[model samples]
Target chain A: MMSDKEPLFSAKNRKLLTNPLGSDNPITIQVLGICSALAVTAKLEPAIVMSISVMAVLALANVIVSLLRNTIPSRIRIIVQLVIVAALVILVDQILKAFAYDVSKQLSVFVGLIITNCIIMGRLEAFALGNKPWPAFLDGIGNAAGYGIILVIVAFFRELLGSGTLYGFKVIPQAFYDMGYQNNGLMILPPMALITVGIIIWVQRSRNKSLIES
Target chain B: MNTQSNTYTFLYAAIMVVIVAAVLSFTSLTLKDRQNMNKEIEKKQNILKAVNVTSTPANAVELFDKYIVEAIIVNSEGEVKSNDKAETFKVDLKHENKKDLSKRKLPVFVFNDTKVGKKLIIPVRGKGMWGPIWGFISMESDRKTIYGATFDHKGETPGLGAEISKPEFQKPFTGKQIFDESGVFTSLKLVKGTASNNPHAFDAVSGGTVTSKGLEAMLQDNLSSYEKFLKSSK
Candidate 1:
């Protein structure tokens, strides 16, 4: 093992932060956390809020799991990870209710459902258990950011086409509507979110040849 | 230190549960008041919307006190049970809906405004396809014609059933009548197809058949329960 003298932002540690932002993205590449991606992407505001919420839960859960790695019984590890996740999710949900009531109302049960988000569980089991707390923290942030990027991109197009607005503002001009332009109704539905994510995956694979299998 | 032992696993789980339970309890207890205040503000805000008075979160409580001149609780027999603000505001329709008709504590808010005139507002609750749906419905002094209405849902399908909460759906309900020309209560109807020229009917949401039907039943059932009160007031 490398000495503790290794610089904090060493190349390996940097890769842990950067890899998930692109080639190893949690949403597009690993295909985790697509349920929330589809549910909240109808509006840009909710998508951004959800992304931040997931990121907070994931990073904290990672650090906690890493710290408890040695003492956690191997037989009950999954349950242990679940309890940490569920607790963090409830904390986030309560905070949102007290402070950001409107956004929390919009998110509804999806906030609580974060307990089931596979991305957090996958990281806790695969990465956090074997790594130091700092690297595990970085991995959590990177993966969640990767997921957020795809969510924001999908929300951008959906809100624009479906509602003809960005973040609830009128982006399309009145003149365009006068010329008989109508917002695409299909874009507002859940199926369109799946299709949008599929399109992103296609474009990403085409750009990065190394991602494709023979 | 044997991680694979059954005894260790049980002990680990037991300790983990205690810690998690304590943390969750502390959070819930600390934030309970603020969370409830937020909810109360939202309820007041929605009640204002039903009467066509817009209000922000910061001003909801003040405006509610201003516009809602009297918060009265009434029974099925059209008799006023209590006019206390705390008692009236605390009337939960979900719980009342589960009780017998004669024992239900129905809340009725009297909204007074110089520009909008006086109106009677009532709350309704029902089951949607996915979960519970509820809303406030306002009526003109005649107790028959709807003035303005607002609806909200727990977990309806976002694009389809959840459309009930939108302004467009609630707008059409403004001028509808709950009672016919003869004064017999014939609660509003939600027509599956076009409503045509019917004064007692409106079109249901297109793709949300179950939710639409549920909302229709909610309106009919709740409005009919107030029949005695409507006739007595008139």
Candidate 2:
């Protein structure tokens, strides 16, 4: 029930979604969600799935927390956020088990660990607590999408070079193997994920001059 | 308004605890049936994997009903125990761990098949590269040939040691004999080379050295206990 003076869907509110992708991206600008970016980016399929799951959780959690901001006491705001996040994570885990058992098994503890992912907590505290629900939800989605874009790119190269495959399908021809072209096994390791992400940031920064400082 | 007593603090804490407990209890009760069903389905799925049958959770029960004919509880000596009060499937491995080895209830699943009329499925669990590895080994009616096998691990590296769970890795176990003609026990071993001409040995993964060894150890340790039962049943 926003007043006419404060429009529900203003230009500034719309900017919340697009701004995070370029100028004020959570990954490049704030440097959040880097841990997951480095862990699950070994394979394109897992990285994509992880990114979507994170986005859904963050956006929904932000909207819910923003809606309940008034009821949360200042002294116990953090506790309330944690409780809500934990409950939501459990629900998500249950849904995954019921619907997508194999993928859920593959994800295992990572889904449960979403509660500890700092980005969700940071967004809730820094933006959702003060902003209206719509804007906060948009911000959450925008930041998640930005993070997802970087992860997918990193996973693409890693999976291609490391396993010579994409989305679990053999992409590199059999001739490549017969010609003694072996997979770069190092690319499948966690350290390679870090180096790949670092290279992505380097390329992105070099191309986009403004992102250099951030 | 004055700072008189701490009654407010105590009351608030008490109310919060009661609310939380009630919520937890309600949630647990509501999901209890579904959780149990999921567990049953998961168990059936694992059993089917043991017999080289692949099926999703949705069709696990159907496949299990089609393949699994009977289940029995046997002692370490391989004798059928009249523990009618306790179902073989309901035997908890964790509870069996603390008890004396001789007293543990071992579940033996019998599968019905045209090729192998009745096969014995034994469950095995032990330490692996990262965490516990478990599997079910189904022996053919002759008690020598392996009907099928399945293995699973927790936290093992994917595409490496974790490949043990894949059918490509497990397929070698089928038709491999577990005992010599002299009734001498020669359990399957994860060999370094190709599967030996001798029926008792199976080839191990080259790169997954530790996990292969772990599988070998797990098979020997868990399956050895069933030898007495196996011998008597024969």
lDDT winner among the candidates?
A: 1
lDDT of 1 by residue, B1-234 (tens): 798899998999999999899999999999999999999999999999999889999999999999999999989999999999878999988889989999999899999999978999999999898999999999999888999999999988777898999998999898888889999888888896666578799889989889999998999888888999988955
Residue-level lDDT tens digits of model 1 in A1-214? 5676778899999999899999999989899988888888999998898888899999999999999999999888998999899899989889989998998888886787688788999899999998889999999999989989999999999999999999999999999999999999999889999999999999999999999988
- True-structure RMSD, every candidate: 1.9, 3.7
- In model 2, the clashing pairs are B78-B229
* Best-performing candidate as measured by TM-score: 1
Question: Ten residues in a row with the worst lDDT in model 2 chain B?
Answer: B1-10
TM-score of candidate 1 relative to the true fold: 0.95
Clashes of each: 0, 1
- Residue pairs with backbone overlap in model 1: none
Model 2 C-alpha lDDT per residue in residues A1-214, reported as the tens digit of each score: 4455666557887788787776776766687887887778888988888888888899988998899776565665687687767766777777676566677778875786678778899899999999888898998898788878888988999999999999999999999899999999899888888888777677777888977654
